[model samples]
Target: MKLPRSIEEIRSDFPILSVKVHDKPLIYLDNGATTQKPVQVLQVMDELYRTANANVHRGVHYLSDIVSERYEAARETVRAFINAPKREEVIFTAGTTASINAVAFSFGERFVHEGDEIIISGMEHHANIVPWQMLCERKGSKLRIIPFSDQGVLDLEAYRSMFTERTRIVAVTHASNVLGTINPVKEIVTEAHRHDVPVLIDGAQSIQHGIVDVADIGCDFFAFSGHKIYGPNGIGVLYGKEKWLNEIPPYQGGGDMVASVTFEKTTYNELPFKFEAGTTNFTGAIGLGTALDYLTALGREAVAEREQALLAQATGGLSSVSGMRIYGTAPGKVSLVSFLPGNIHPYDAGMILDKMGIAVRTGTHCAQPVMDRYGITGTIRASMAFYNTEEEIDALVKGVRKVTEMFA
Candidate 1:
């Protein structure tokens, strides 16, 4: 598959990719945690801080007005990127963790009651799992899990049978961070809607890999982190349907989320702002918008193709090693691989790889349940991005071989 631009050209956009570690050229394969930001995103953020730094909304000053416009424009960009029906449906939060927690609190308060059930898959990151678990504990509800196969595919048949009248909402990941499984969320949403259940997709891992159309998936809510998509840290988008946004209470009681405050009572602001309490991340939001624009210009389809090619290469190269055990072998996974080289502990393997200037994620990867399911403690994971190259994949293979020999 052809990339939208040359690999060198695309890699040049991210300055950090050129940096060395331990006197060796850096080969970063940790995109699953957070992607390196492009210069375009960095420049926009720097420019905003330099020229238009100010608080957003309800300000008469020139800096505030300009910054506010940019901030709201970032919301619109997020709305468009996710293909949400209304711009007001988009809410900015600290990141995916914050987004999921906000929904758990607000949506739980609005809908959940004693004995109610919430359906989440076994492969979910803690961000998706714990909030629901907290909500269940708070509301005297039960948290139901959808089991996955040994191959890392969710049991849709079991998922369909799990919903009941007491079911409040269905929360699932669009892609598994550890498994790299690209779940059939559209079908999952359809099944939930058949039961009159609303669905929330954790898009933190999927958004950076491919197109994420909320309308197409038919999920009622979606959450993703900006940093995972080559944007600034501490910014994320939560897209909720208008009906739900209107129904749920504000997540926090603070400055911008209020319409008025009286001694007797306090009224809340309108949609979007209702969820955005206190001071907003206006500069980070603008930076995220620039990052989205940069990704769009690169052509998401072509980017996906490049990443898939890298995934294939990594999978093949890693599989050839003796005593290698890959954890997630789903057929249509994203660009990541989780594995153990023989009985070698993941932490030891990771340290050796780091010394060789190859960066990879180690341990349970925030998905301890996934590790438990496989009867292992943790795995060394190499996650790829569009900027990653074939040479890097080859290097990773060689590094793993070295790790295996050292342990032997």
Candidate 2:
């Protein structure tokens, strides 16, 4: 499988891209919410459930062995994808929400004291914010937010200044889901380390954009979702440094997460298994592996270039629309666009685009604090993926123009 030379070839792998919506060809520009899975991912997951479905790490049966082996193989795939030092550092969870929650609970229990503070940013998705808020509320700690510029870039100076003796941990997003801004997480990690604080990056929106080397970024922990990257919905990854994973107590205890158990005394499993409790999403993990395989075969650099082209087209075309207000005009950003055209509600524009079979996301985008910062309810978001084309961006631009004229 040589890398795709054009968007059409890349689009062929995803069957849903061929479908019609409202009797019009579907233009999927909402990849940031959840990407449409390729047939490769589907086939891999289906094969597992069909032939090798069984409880993993428990039975000596052939099916169980096959399932368990494949499941761990998937873990290796995840470890390599993020460039984690050890495969055991990659822990599977329901999604990014669950991953962040696990870190907040276990890390908070270990380190966060009553007067301590957890640092996050104004641009964070609620998944990153609320968990720390919950942890703070529980431990009588404080939640401090690093402010961003109106252009949607995080203020590093503010980030540096916010750290104090009470600052226990720092959690920030690698990229803004709503703003399309790519944060300097390496510098963030370095700055946090200067104050002897460990940093965790929310890579939910960043992973699919380009290479995310956690070691290179020097982050203590990283979390991202599979669904956002053309994989299954129920699977996500949490990559923690072995030292941190070793120190934080298990977030949950059951079945595979235990090493030995008696009625009175119980011993927990090692590294990854200590976090993976009860029935694991073995099938979903397999699908995620396939998704990563497909993505890598396509070439990350090529995909990034194509996405940037799509973003350029979308941004340039939409700029011509009267009263257009594009958000997040940072010098450095990924290939996604979120904007408002006049005072027209984002939902209204999004619905109109949907009617044209031009799919786009609207509303707070699960980042209400961002909306509050801008003193607006929400903006329409059109996030691009490698499979997206200039034609789709054209359709979105045209749809936006039509929507704006209707309201004008």
Candidate 3:
């Protein structure tokens, strides 16, 4: 079967392309931060606001029933998207950070004892790193970091050596947002399981890349954000193994998370509801469902092929430029290229590209330890999605060349 040659049809659905920044066509390459929403996702949210706007699982009225039905359907969609075991295993939170915090606060408190060790990789974003640090501090546990090699791959030998009886949890990113390195998560999870340690994978970057199945990966927990996957902001998912979910305590206390309350004691709700406490992002959930549907319709094989082609073209073109140093030269990477131009700050490079209406992220990318490992402050990151075009990449190369010439 033949797939679409170019993503032009998909790109046309985003209305933001009409806007001009500096009388130049906008070239959006900051997809690692967040993706532009398609018309279908926007329309889904609009339809909810116009017709079925109501709080879910609270009211018995007609609109409430409709909203609640859609919300629950969204959970099913997420379950299918990740190939999770059941709908109840999916918990909705604000984003990846909130989901990780839920696990840290609930599971950490219950499972982690003093002198126990929590292992994480050095390539983790602050969202993944800080929560475990805080959890370890509170529990009087120690945080162990698995260092990366000079080529940007995780030090597997070091990671395996770090595992011991006291290692309660192992949390790491499936794909590094800054480095674009896709970690061998299946191997990591399997190795951790051999030591009787649970593993959590931060899928914030991997969810949009291609296919992901928690059961297939054998991860105890997986987390991702909606906005990064073309859905609305303030919505995300946490997928936990049923056994693990059953063991963890409630993350927060409030309306829906409780079964019965008394002056003396309280009984909590089951599985997912025990984690989701307050008013949730009903519209965002509906939007995320629509986004997943759109992506599924496109097919993961096709998305992966197109994005890999784009990455090859972009990386090849950038390598031809003088004084361009690309970071994250690992053998297998996603559709992102981080680089530094000789004698130019990443912020200055980003500023120059911004004048040409090119949008790219330039900073530590919330992975300070990775930056420190590379012995650099930061790199200008150009992350692409399947909807991006070759013409856009050409424009980016031209802009970077111009910046280099001017700065030189």
Candidate with best lDDT: 1
Model 2 segments beyond 4 Å from truth?
1-3
Candidate 1 whole-model C-alpha lDDT, 0 to 1: 0.94
Give the Å error, residue 21, model 1.
0.4
Instruction: Show where candidate 3 strays beyond 4 Å.
Output: 1-6
**Clash pairs, model 2 backbone:** none
TM-score of each: 0.99, 0.98, 0.98
Native-vs-model 2 lDDT?
Answer: 0.91
The residue-by-residue lDDT of candidate 2 on 288-316, one tens digit each, is 98898888888877777777777888889
Tens digits of per-residue lDDT for model 3 on 109-202?
A: 8999999999999999999999999998899999999998877899999999998889999999999998899999999999999999999999
Clashes of each: 0, 0, 0
